[model samples]
Target: MWLEIGRQHLSLWRNIEIVMVNAMIPWGNHLLLPLGTLREPFSALKRADVVIVHHADMASKLEIQAIESMVHKYNESVPIFFSILAPSHFIRVGNISYTCPLKDISHAILLCVSAIGSADSFVQRIHKMGPMHVDRLDFSDHHSFQPKDIDIIRKRLHKLESDFSAVPMMVVTEKDYFRRPEVLEHLGYEVLVLCSSLQILPLKGCNEESFKKCLRQHLEIYNLA
Candidate 1:
């Protein structure tokens, strides 16, 4: 279905196909459909004129090389770029307009709560903030928080507070907070929403400027812009 849609777009003569890949699990089990995480076969990468790898910060150099090799296997000349979700700031849960500094959690105990695609990446990033200790409550991607889940989170937080004998705060990704702001606000505890934006990583001659230049070149090639 997606290939058909891409073909339809390309048939218009002004469209260029770009594919985004998650660096954490590029090709889950290398299987397709219900058996694995991929929607299409790896060979489908041949259709992509440009490919951007997300969460590049979390992946190691070897992993990126493997991904590049795999992409080149299908399309040797496809332009590959790397990007990371750079955490910008934090917003208080109840008051969305109130922004908090990333250092606010420094030397503080935090319970990282998230239901995102890359929970490990989110937690690891938090660890880098110099938190006294970080505990996590990760749910499956897009899993909505239920009453029982709330109870579980509360219990975990309570345990952390008791163990550390300090006030433990809750932190969640922007995706989780936006999914159900009211749910987090009602937790009756300090909950912060970590916000991040996509940033181009400087790797193998790829940076913000080069990424834009490449895009412009592609646009000129396809006459899209």
Candidate 2:
């Protein structure tokens, strides 16, 4: 049904020449079900033209090789790219929205709140900002923050101040920030939302220019067709 819809759209729009499907595979010991976050079997990756391995930087060299080997075992010729999720900026949740650099949060004690798939990665990225400490409050993916959750956060903040003798800043993912902006703002404390973006990792034998060229080559083929 999806393919039919794609065909119909292609018929209507002459410019629609190529269709690419991406599979988001994170770095983990298992790429299949029963243990890790993977919903589908690694064999399903055979259907993908390009496989993107996210959190590439988080994986060690040995782990990357293992993942690459596993992927090649299934699909030898498909282009596999590595990517890292880097924090771009922090959004201040208040009357007037503003952005701050990660450097600004340095030496700060942070209360990290997130309901993302990879909560540990989020915390690790926050630590990369050189914060003095990060007290994480993780939730299941897309879990909405409730009043009780807010209460828990407040208690944690108080504990942080009492323990560290420093005012701790509240940090959240951008997704959570947009989900409950008003709730977070009314918490009687300042909140800074971290925004992240993906960055492609250069291959072992490829330079930036060459990798960019390879990306462009894929799109350039459609124009010729």
Candidate 3:
């Protein structure tokens, strides 16, 4: 429909092809669709010319293979790339802030706060950073935190410390910090904000260069025209 509309309205434009219809499927092992977190049935993959499995590094080999197999079943010809959201650095939330390496938080008890749709993935990524422990308090996606919410987080952090007998550090996603900077700042503890970026997994048949070529070829058409 988009192609037809583009052609109808802008017929003078030349050589426009929908080179690829890419679909992003987060690394998840669950029941298909209705029963679980899947946005669509595995069969829906047939429409995708390329599939990106994000957070691939966090998943076990078996889990990765399972996801790959499911995608191949629906669309064997479609190229599937495994990708990881690797953490780059931690930015302190305050008036005068500094960045730290992910390893700097090693062995520290963490109170992870997030309202992201992929809260489980956030927790997994945080744990992978080698923190001694992570206790997550999840809210609805894009939840604008209120004073009551701050209180809830404080209570959870205290509980985590008392139960584990360790002083816990506060951690939040970049989104959470941007949404309510003042609220997190006023809280009596230092908060660490995590930043991450996509790192394509280099597999046997597919690698970073190959993935870049695929994307470049798709967009090159527009560039040339």
Candidate 4:
């Protein structure tokens, strides 16, 4: 959350195993971006160890530059990982499931999309996921459950079904799902949650692996002296 790590870093740290970090908005019980967005004047990212430049929003880039610039005063050659999120979902079917790119999903009825954390970034990634129609719903991070909000979402689903042939179920990220109480009570069996991992290196150059390798090698040499 502090540095908004990428998949490459996550993968490397996890030894190439899938590693997914929770990105629910607020990131906690309070504060929409306690550390990820660095909403404070300049309190946090400047202190980050590694910063991920994966969000597609213009603000993410600005934040990356600002954070890097501020941190530079303390350490000029800090490592920054540029990344891209593949619009993929991690399906958990009684713990016997795996990750799949969104386009590959054929049986899913509704593309329930929302992200209290970096919604813009999530939206761009979703565009790449596929052509399944979605009833996108967004809420503030750590946003408390309100019956009214559920009603609103339900109403949208009803409308989505009216337009589509299927009844349209639900699909959301693990991060956002935890915030909703209804998700546990009703969605556990009904909704299909898509899980994803972070990849925080070199999407900008589209050579994330090489970029990470370069950064690691550079860091190794720097530490050698």
Candidate 5:
């Protein structure tokens, strides 16, 4: 249905279509939706004028090559690009606008909590920040925190404090923080939101400028620019 809509938009309205693949688990199990993660077959790449692999920073060179090989199988000439979520700064749970330095959590015990799709990436990024210790609690993507969940987190925080002889800080992705800041703010532990922004990675002759140029070329080809 989505593919048909894209075709209609392209053929009828001359819209340029761009497709994104998750570098973490592209074509999960290589099965379509209801059985696995793919919404369409690998052949769907043929429809994409531009293909972007997200979370490239988390993927290894071999993994990226595998993804690129798969994409090229169906759309051999399509321009492929890579992107990553680059951590920018931190913000307190209640004070969303106030930015904090990434080093604030350095050498501090951290309980990384998140309900985002890429929890591993989130935790990995935190580990790179030189924290004294890193622990994590992952829930399904977009899971809303409830009172029971709060109790669980509080218990974990207590345990970490007991073991480390210091009050461990709670760290979460911006998505989780904004999902229910009120609930998080009342957790009674210092909670910080890890803020990140999408950045194009320089790979395979593609960088930010080259990615923009590719978009412009596609728009010109479709006469949509």
Candidate 6:
């Protein structure tokens, strides 16, 4: 009875046996989904038990509020909530946890990035890693990458992996890498990726406890659980 609401293939919906819905399902070079339309129809919101909103940092406050409003409007009976995202809670780097920072992150090289969750937010979370210097290759949520595409990416990485290159490694979000298991193809370059979770400190109402509230909100909606 769980449904993962997204624009396309997301890990949360990957192994789900039931039918899944998406806003925009990518098909090769084309998008096959209608934006904002749900497969269950608007009336199905009545069965919803919760409404979770996210992307507070990357999106404007108005945007987040708008999402909340949309969810509430669709399922007024459902309890609206928030949940923290990966990289906001902590990052697992090669089986190790590392505290992420907003500044002074230009230390790691070659960021192999992918996410069935939030690619933008994850990339932004590691912005301190570099300014336009990071190898930012994002895949669609649960993207069944084609051999051609993977080859292209490998070639691109090979071409980009050099001493003068920005970062000579691959960084990926743990979500995608864990699911497909084919994302570990950084043979000729240093590999770097987000491991597990990260702690986030919001700029507004900045406090440990209040931040915890926001974190909870993000997790409730964003997490597959």
How well is each residue in 122-164 modelled by candidate 5, as lDDT tens digits? 8989999999999899998889999999999999999999999
How does each model score on TM-score?
0.89, 0.79, 0.76, 0.57, 0.89, 0.58
Could you arrange the candidates by TM-score from highest to lowest? 1, 5, 2, 3, 6, 4
The RMSD (Cα, Å) of candidate 3 is: 5.8
Q: Write the per-residue lDDT of candidate 4 for residues 1-225, one digit (tens) a residue.
A: 333344324244422211122233212242434444533323343444444544423345555556446545544554555554544555643342555555554544564556565665565455455546655777775666566666777777777777886677666666776666354344323455566665554444536676567657656765675
How many clashing pairs per prediction, in order? 0, 0, 0, 7, 0, 32
Residue by residue across 1-225, what tens digits does model 3's lDDT show? 011223333346644322111123342344543465444545556655556766666666777677677667778887777666678999998952689888988999999999986788789778888988888888987899999999998888888789899878899888888988888887776789998887778974888999888878767865876
Better of 2 and 4 by lDDT: 2
Q: Is candidate 3 or candidate 5 better by lDDT?
A: 5
Mark the regions of model 3 whose C-alpha exceeds 4 Å error after superposition: 1-36, 41-43, 161-166, 221-225
Q: Candidate 2: misplaced stretches above 4 Å?
A: 1-36, 206-225
The local lDDT score (0 to 100) that residue 81 gets in candidate 5 is 87
Candidate 1 lDDT by residue in tens digits, 116-136 = 767888999999999999999
Distance from true location, Cα of 203 in model 1, Å: 1.3
The better-scoring model by TM-score among 3 and 4 is: 3
- How well is each residue in 91-115 modelled by candidate 2, as lDDT tens digits? 8888435779889889998999998
